[model samples]
Target: MGRLSGKVAVVTGASSGMGSEIVKLYAKEGASVVAVARRQNRLEELAASLADAEGKVEIFPGDISDKAVNEAMIDFAVEQFGKFDILVNNAGIMDDMAGVDAFSDEKLLKVFSVNVYGPFYATRKAVNTFKEQGNPGAIIHIASEGAYKTCAGAVYCASKAAVVALSRNTAYMYMHDGIRSNCIIAGGFKTEISTSMGMPNMEAYGKLKAVLGTAPEPGEPTEIAKACLFLASDDSAYVNGAELAVDGGWCAS
Candidate 1:
């Protein structure tokens, strides 16, 4: 049997990149998933692709930053799947690689709204659902290596730093209640976010990261998905409030 057999999970940003991969892996591992994102077609495509998987995938197209959407996502998961056991707060955006001096208030607010507020809103709903159902829950935050290092623009880093802090506090406050919260400090990956930032190809990106001295190459979405799987499964039952750096040693140097 798969590690997450019989579990129910909700993954944000499920339309693409790491989020899409996570949805696929979760279903493969025997978990019913509610895949949440803003793109209806993409979500539908994902759901269709997993039609023969070991579990189910239900799509929810909406913005994770909206409080109502967050609430509804949890509701959809529980109402559709019988229960919600895991939440992957994976929807996030990046700001132009501009310093604080050149950063506009709009840019700062937008990044924080998606990266920080979205997780907060969803986490609130998930925690409350676990409370109402009297069940243990796992909350996974897809943070960036930028949260711990200064390799990117200020707004994005600060926003993710807030995510790290929030995850830690959630774990501390809820461990006794059987709720677990953790952050994946992921390194550079060839996701839409990187392409949006105008980053070079993955090989070029790896070369750039190599300047930091013997770091691993840029990671794949599937790599991070696997790490998330570990955290979401009973394998991580004793892990809480931990920052798992699946960043290919970017934070090591």
Candidate 2:
């Protein structure tokens, strides 16, 4: 049997990058998946790809930073799949490079809204559902290496650090309920987020390869997806309040 057989999972930011991979992997492992994201078209495409898989997949599109959206996500999961087993709070954002003084309040709030409040709201909803359903479930937050290491700017790094602490404390608080919480500290990946942040187009991609002694190869979302699967599945029955680093050894260097 697959690792997630007889399970149902909800993954946020399900349209692309790590979130999309988590959604796909969970379904492949035999979990009925509720894919949540703001991009309805992308979510629909992902859902279609998983349609013929061993597990079921459904798509819900909305801005996770909104509390109403978060509540609807949980409601949709129950309405479609009957129960919830796992929640991957993976939606987030980064700001353009700016000094603390230079950063705009609007930008800071936007980042926090999606990165911090989004997960917080989603977790609250998920925990409530888990309690009412009387099912032991897992919640995994996709934090960044920034959470533990020094990184650019203040907002993104600080927000992620908060997420790390949130997961740890929540794990301890809900252990008796058989609900587990964890965070994945990921390294830099060549995702749309990076592209939007002006990482390198084809020309600069080559120049960077020449200068930085070759940029560290980006970590695949599937690798992180497997980690999420381990945590969500009974394989991690004893694992809780743990921060798993999927940083491709960036912390070592």
Question: Which numbered prediction scores highest in lDDT against the true structure?
Answer: 1
Distance (Å) between predicted and true CA of 179, model 2? 0.6
95-124 per-residue lDDT for model 1 (tens digits): 766666666687788888889999999999
Put down candidate 2 lDDT per residue, 22-132, tens digits, no spaces: 888888889999998888999999989888777899889899889999989889989998889899999888765444655668768988899899999988888889999
Among all windows of 10 consecutive residues in model 2, the one with the lowest summed lDDT is 196-205
Candidate 1 clashing pairs, residues 3+ apart or interchain: none
Q: Which stretches of candidate 2 lie over 4 Å from their true place?
A: 195-215
Candidate 1: stretches off by over 4 Å: 198-215
Which ten-residue region of model 1 has the weakest summed lDDT? 199-208
TM-score of model 1 relative to the true fold?
A: 0.93
